[model samples]
Target: MSERIYSDYLNEYCKDSSIFLVKESEGRVKNFLNLDQEIPDQYRWRFSDLNSIVKQVRSENTRQGLNKIYWTDQSRNIEAYIIMTWWRGNELVRSCLNGLNRREVIVPAIAARSLLELSTVFLLNANTLEKNFKKIMFPPETIVISTDIENLVAKMIWGTRYQPKDELLTQTNIMTALKKLAKSPGTKDLMPTYDFLCDIAHPSFIGNTSYWSHIEVINPDGSERRLMSRLTDRQYNTEITDKTLWALAWSSTCIYNAFIIMRDAYSGLLKKI
Candidate 1:
């Protein structure tokens, strides 16, 4: 597995429809942003705690070494990719939290979506390494599992860290990654939230029309009803803002957990090796 393209991965691992699960998820995405409900009191506390934890966890970036790593060049390369991946995820969590504080909707949702994607992929790779530490660390030239797994990890890191600004692209099929994330152990509950964030991140109905615009019922002649759409200048409706806050908080928490899990797993595996 020499880091094949998205289509090649799809062709080998997927069935006839590459976008089937993604399409299914799209229909399941809801317009909950328009719900007329107050923010939960517990969510307010959770949001504050999330902010504090994010600030604290962000301070751990300077600790880069594996303390007592003993591995070959290949393992070291993987370690470096994992470290950079963690940094990228941390940056996204901060960006999403900042957007939430500013009451920004679309951009924060976008950032949260990216954060979720990164966290999911990192968890995937980390879990794989944990289960097959010796196999992955001491990979042979022709082992299908090791190469494919390595390339998958590399694809995510490369897409985020190496792509040029002018021709930016992601190597992973986002929906595929998300589906895998949802099905993976300890992450099944995140599917709905991830789908909702996807709805907000894209320029679809809930993402744009319901999020950035409101409807007005105008009765000009008192005999007929006409509906009008008005832009909000990026201002969030009260309920929408609350929902976005929850989303950002939830995504930030997920990323933070991923970072801790990754760091510990990397260190633990290095010591074992």
Candidate 2:
């Protein structure tokens, strides 16, 4: 299927979800921005990284449109748009993450869409970073760690290069890589949740459960009738369930943290002009 706008997603998924639960998630987003803002040695590593990119982008551009991205033309500013999309994806996921947490009833419905966006962002950012690794100046360990994982995943999933499917945007490829990463010894605990969330996020039968219907009647011919209906009793005016609320906060935090390096590169692009 092709991509969809946000409202379409909301209308379909949020109808049976909890508004109060979604509202509760907004309060948690800010803490994701900074864990130790009051401390002497703050943990604002992402902030510093973003600032570096900003400085670089500013210095490189003699043209006023260093910041320009090919939003419509697609031909102009390809690199800029790739980087911008990386940021834009994060920004939207952040907002969507926040909006869904505090307002929707069935949080996973919204989560599926957010994860879809993040998955794309992941592919784009990783590929773009690799393409411009030298300019990004990422730490040797940082680069090595991700590449190592990709290589391991590729080998395991496809039996080495014989049946290569290394396309970054391929959902199976990304899923294999992410599942492997999440299953690593240190991350084992989250394996189930990660896989479950992957199901919700991926374009699969499970993700569309938001549109599930009631089977109230059997026709005279004994054919089943799956009528369009809300899971009304499941609705809530109460807080979002603990698990969902935490997931929203966690995903938003994850995206924000992930963008530090990429944002730095984006800023560098502006400077390089």
Candidate 3:
């Protein structure tokens, strides 16, 4: 098989304002998911526009769902399941964008990480559906596992008050899904931003003291040693805020692309069934 040249598809599909292209060898170009340089729009108007694109597609998906039922009992209700997942992803992206606009730090970072994982899973599920269109009785195992984990979490959280059913099973190892996404040609670049978001999302040094106010530590002899974190710094937290906005922008793009992939896959499957 010939190597997939992404520039052609990217140029054809992506908006010039939203994407930055880098020239590769042999006159080819690579898609860089963010702006080439920081635009004057520090409030991220362009990022908000990207979220609008996602929201529009989600609206279309809603109409499609209401138009007809795609998956049947024989198909194990895969269409409803996958489409709802995309809708949920849409809501997550909107919330992340809102948080970004509000200048929230940790919540947007955490939401960006979640959007990245959901976007990658949508791509993976689209691939599986395309390959196994005929013999599939259910969605991919990843989808099933993810749903089970979500249900289990809901049950575990509300089980005491409502006593939800025991639907708990194995959990999803996100690294596994991320590894698969890294192997793909179009999505490999997302890993770096995702890694950065993970660092901020986790309750580690980068997530805690790094974003907090620091006080100069004095040695016993009056010599300054280092800075010790005193409290969370909302006044001058540029690093975390800037990095989180960039990642959230990329996450928005990923969510849009994943929706398109899933939309196409659903269209094809609907034609077949």
Candidate 4:
């Protein structure tokens, strides 16, 4: 059968189940093939490595889900889907407990700890990627590490909130953390990535007049749904100085500590792994 005919047949077969899934899966495969065709010999190898990792992770997850999945193309074979059992449920439970008193001191502290764990993971990944990958387009820098942690903290805190205005205002905290990191002796060497980080931290036009601040997933079949909120005024300005970097780092560390405590309560889950 022709490629088009094969795709059409698959579409018809899976239409009742998940048309979107079929299309997205096929599209990813096609995009990867196109990249292999267009990229240089040297760069093609890197893309291949990345594509393999993507496929491996997806396959692992699929299998874990107990789904009888199949893939038509050999290069596009679907693998197991491994889902982490300990999800946001643990976080929500912790939040509920922490909401008992008006003081609400523990909840924020827990949030800070989670932020730190995430930052440390990113920092480790950055170092690993730097060492493993050759001819990297973006070199690893301490400034990048500081900026990334700041962004992560911003997302964790503001992204969880339901207010767009509040989310947009997170820039202040982000900037503060950056400045603190830059000033610290440990992070002083990352001064070079400082300017670049600042540029990305500034705000820009959101392009929509309507305050589409929140998102919802509604299942027509009366299934459970998930909702996510959106942040407005999304723009980055690149004028970060050493002072700004230091401040941002300090703010991030405070939040990171909070996140860690909350995560520690669920440390049993970590021990399982």
Q: Which candidate is the best by lDDT?
A: 3
Write one digit per residue (lDDT tens) for candidate 1, span 1-273: 133212332223223433333222211111111111221212211122336545654554432222122122335555566556655655675565455444456776777667667767766666666566544343223222245544554464556434534223356566787787777565554677677767776667666544444334556665544333343343334433434444444444554455456556556656543
User: Cα miss at 142, model 1 (Å)?
Assistant: 18
lDDT of 4 at 184: 49
Off by over 4 Å in 1: 1-70, 134-153, 159-170, 184-189, 210-243
Pairs that clash in candidate 3: none
* TM-score for each of the candidates: 0.53, 0.38, 0.52, 0.19
Regions of candidate 4 where Cα sits further than 4 Å from its true position: 1-103, 135-273
Q: Pairing residues by index, what is the TM-score of model 1?
A: 0.53
> What is candidate 4's lDDT per residue for 1-273, written digit by digit as tens?
124321343334334533233333333323323323432333111122346656655765434221111111111110000001012323432342233112222232334234333343333323332332222122222111123433433343334333556654343343444454556456553434434333333331321212233335557887655432233231212121122222223323322332333333223222222
Report lDDT (Cα) of residue 233, candidate 4. Answer: 30
> Candidate 4: how large is its RMSD?
23.9
Q: How accurate locally, in lDDT, is each candidate?
A: 0.49, 0.43, 0.49, 0.31
Q: Is candidate 1 or candidate 2 better by TM-score?
A: 1
Where is model 3 poorest over a 10-residue stretch in terms of lDDT? 23-32
Q: Which ten residues in a row have the lowest lDDT in candidate 2?
A: 67-76
Candidate 3's C-alpha runs over 4 A off are 1-71, 74-76, 134-172, 186-189, 213-239
